[model samples]
Target chain A: MDIPTYADVEAAHARIALHIHRTPILTSSFINDLTGAELFFKCENFQKAGAFKARGASNAVFGLDEKMAKVGVATHSSGNHALSLSYAAGKRGIPVTVVMPRTAPEPKKAAVRGYGGHIVECEPSTSSREAVFAEVVAETGAEFVHPYNDPRVIAGQGTCSKEMVEDLGELDAVVAPIGGGGMVSGCCLTLSTIAPKTKIYAAEPKNADDAYRSFKAGRIIADDAPQTVADGLKVPLKELTWHFVSKHVEDIFTATEEEIVAAMRLIWERMKIVMEPSSAVPLAAILKNKELFAGKRVGVIVTGGNVDLGKLPWAQS
Target chain B: MDIPTYADVEAAHARIALHIHRTPILTSSFINDLTGAELFFKCENFQKAGAFKARGASNAVFGLDEKMAKVGVATHSSGNHALSLSYAAGKRGIPVTVVMPRTAPEPKKAAVRGYGGHIVECEPSTSSREAVFAEVVAETGAEFVHPYNDPRVIAGQGTCSKEMVEDLGELDAVVAPIGGGGMVSGCCLTLSTIAPKTKIYAAEPKNADDAYRSFKAGRIIADDAPQTVADGLKVPLKELTWHFVSKHVEDIFTATEEEIVAAMRLIWERMKIVMEPSSAVPLAAILKNKELFAGKRVGVIVTGGNVDLGKLPWAQS
Candidate 1:
């Protein structure tokens, strides 16, 4: 497979512009005071299908050749990507099947179905996920759109950073949560080409620190069943995403579950925006490692807002 | 005392240009489909002090001459106005004293203090509120800024509609939640002038339906201690606000507590914005009275967002 380039990202943006929202950027004086860094939040939480994954999903679904599109599309995702692809398929009036772990948030499952996507359940393990997804593809003859590893999806995700830089001019740095490193890799591809002076930082939950481990060790590491409140970020990285992460990322910073929840709550209370725990990881990392970001103008990708309102991370169990 | 006019609203907007945020407008296709109306939400929750009250408060504080500014400003309120006045006063480096109900949310109280305002607790009664406020103004020699009844404050609040109409062209009608009727009166004051054909609707909690009763009976009826999850709507309409509510408002609608909570949750879940229960009242009313708004372009003022996230109205007791 060929590694996706900035040109691919530009093509993805042009193809998906009509389908995706040019989501707004929000800033907070309170958050700026907390870390002494001027931070701009790219509110992808308001994105169609409630995530930045909609960018990649739309790119994959819309970019399909006439013959391949006739077969429809399928993917195995913990949550966001599943619903995003479902949204794109629903828009195009094509069939989509998502293999999801049964433990995925009920909200995401309901949203996927709301967008007319079928769900195939799997155990929260890579073996079960791959097996179930393959079974669905074989049964339906669906064109498989890999959640993160595919060059097309990487190119699609890169469009987020492209919009961010174009809207914000140049930022001193950019931070985004790293789950399978799809968003980070996209940021890397765009920032390296367009804003070459900008530093890219990847934030991860300490409980699911596979990306941090991979960056520090210079090799890919997989976690079988990492547990954290940030359910969307428990998956391991793939070859396509790791390509950009290893080459262009400045560093990977990790925040504990407590820090993640606190940062999420702060944004909810102070900035008055609803976002999932995964989206808060970048702010959590910045707050924890203040020296690295202090006095700098940074961009934080607010990844998504699809979470059960009843199951907020800080709610007393 | 004289009523505030469009000229005053325009002047207030100029005076407050430096002290307040020209808050953004948001819309949800899901909500529009559900209600069969094109809903434009003016998000005053993202206002400088997390409420539309900031406009009035900023105008009042900033409009004061240097001699009156030396003594600062004071108000008696439940929550949003208290914090809003504090926020405006803080910006001017002036003293602000607030006579607030002891039962007000802790988050609002914390914000008031954070903005360098002194809070004096009053009982949840009009008599106590007036008495406590009088004592504070006398003791501190502060200029009294009525939460809603003042012409300056009404003109300031009217600016919200001026901005909304400027950005949205002409809506078929405008809906705003009625607490003490500041925001609704502002809407009436502006829509009646610039967009004369656009009707105005006021929403109230059924539990605190003084505004509805006032509209029905053709006279203002005071509520002693109405109870509702939307704490901000507990106050009764005053003479100045009653003028607009009686003459210009098309109708007043009351919503049940359950409906208000549902609408609040729907916006938070779908629109991905944090807004107070009071803000949801207008949408709740719209959902109930669909015939009045169906197939029309409607504007709903999202009042404020300064709620304790720990105590969301939808959360279990």
Candidate 2:
């Protein structure tokens, strides 16, 4: 697969600009005082479909030709990507299908359906998901849009950092939680070319430390359903994402489960913003490594805000 | 007591401009669709000290003359007002004392001390609070800043609606949760003169519906020790706040406990913003009275975001 370039990201931004929300960047003096770092939160929690995945999903959905769009787009994600793609497809008046494990959270399934996506239930395994997804694509003759691996998706995700850099000039560092490395890769694709001076860091949960392990081993280290409060970071990095991660990422940091939950609660309490545990990983990394970030202007990408409120990490479930 | 005018609100805004945050105005398309009204949320939950009380507290602390300022300020409350006063006083580098019930939440007391405010514990009753506050004032010779009754504080809070009206030109209605009527009075003070055509609605929890009763009775029907999930709305309307409520407020709406909690959860899940139960009352009222607000542009004040996460209404305690 070809690696997405800055030009491709810029093109994606233009194509998806009208479809996706230009989310605001927020700051909290209380948090700044706590960490001694000037943190700028790119609040993609407020983004369309309540996540940054909306950008990539919208780009792919809208970029299709009328004939292709009529048949529509399909993906296999039970997370934000599924709902985001469905939302984008709905906006474009196209039929979209999401293949999800039968054991996926009911709320997540409901969200996909709410966005007008048809759901195809699969067995709870990687092989099963792939096998079921292939059948869906073949049956429907729909265009397959990979959540993060596709060049078009990476190009779309790149628009987040583009807007961040444009809004907040000359940040010392940019940080994001590394799930499949889509957002970080997008940041790398943009910053490495436009603002190369700004260091890029990816944060991961210690429980699901595949990206961190992968970074140190100088290769992709897949984890088999690693359990963590940050469900978003359980997935491993793909080739396209690894291409940007290995080349442009400064470091990948890990935060313990306790740290991730604490940081998540802190943002909710202080910044008055709702975010998923995955989004809190970057702040956790910053908190864990205070000396490295202190007195620096840092851009922290709040990846998404799609959580089961009833099953909040802190709430006794 | 002199009635606060738009001029007073404008002067208060100017005085507290540097000290308080001009919080953002946010809109949720999902919420707009749910209620069938164009809603503009004045996010005071994002205000300094995590509540709109910060505006009132800052105005009181900063408006003091040099001699009065040397002595500092004091208030008696166990809610957002106490912490906000402390925060405002800390900003001005002035000593402030809070007389709070010994049974007040530990987090609330901690926040007061965190902002460098001295705390004097009192019995959890209005009479006890007044007695302790008087003693504190006598001992320290500090200016007693009332929670809602004071003209300066009302004027300070009026700035919230002033900014809301300014941001969203010509709102059809302005809604706020009535907790001692401070925020609602502030809205009335500003809207009555500047945007008199805009109807003002006050929302209250049916469990603690003193403001609703008072508005209907044409006299203060104060409720003592009212219980509600919205802990912030337990306080009754004082004379000064009642003055604005009686004159300018079009109607006071009450939401059942279930409706308030549901509205609170909806905002958190859909809007991805952290707001306390008190803040959700206005949205609840709008949902209940769809006919009054349907197809109209309404400005809703999100009162505060200082709820105890451990004891969240949805969470099992």
How well does each candidate superpose onto the true structure, as a TM-score?
0.99, 0.98
lDDT of each: 0.93, 0.90
- For candidate 2, the docking band is high
TM-score of predicted structure 1: 0.99
Interface RMSD of each: 0.6, 0.7
Best of the candidates, lDDT = 1
Cα lDDT tens digits, model 2, B1-317, are: 77777888989999999988889888988899999999999999999998999999999998888888888999998678999999999998998999988877677788899999999999876778888888898899889899999999999999999898788877999999998989999988889888889999999999999889888889998877778888888888999999989999999999999999999999998999999999999999999999999999999999899888777787752
Query: Least accurate stretch of 10 residues (summed lDDT) in model 2 chain B?
Result: B308-317
Which regions of candidate 2 fall more than 4 Å away from where they truly are?
Answer: none
Give the chain B TM-score achieved by candidate 2: 0.97
Residue lDDT tens for model 1, A181-295: 8899899989999999999999999999999999899999998989999988998988888889999999999999999999999999999999999999999999988998999
True contacts kept of each: 0.86, 0.97
Candidate 2 colliding pairs: none
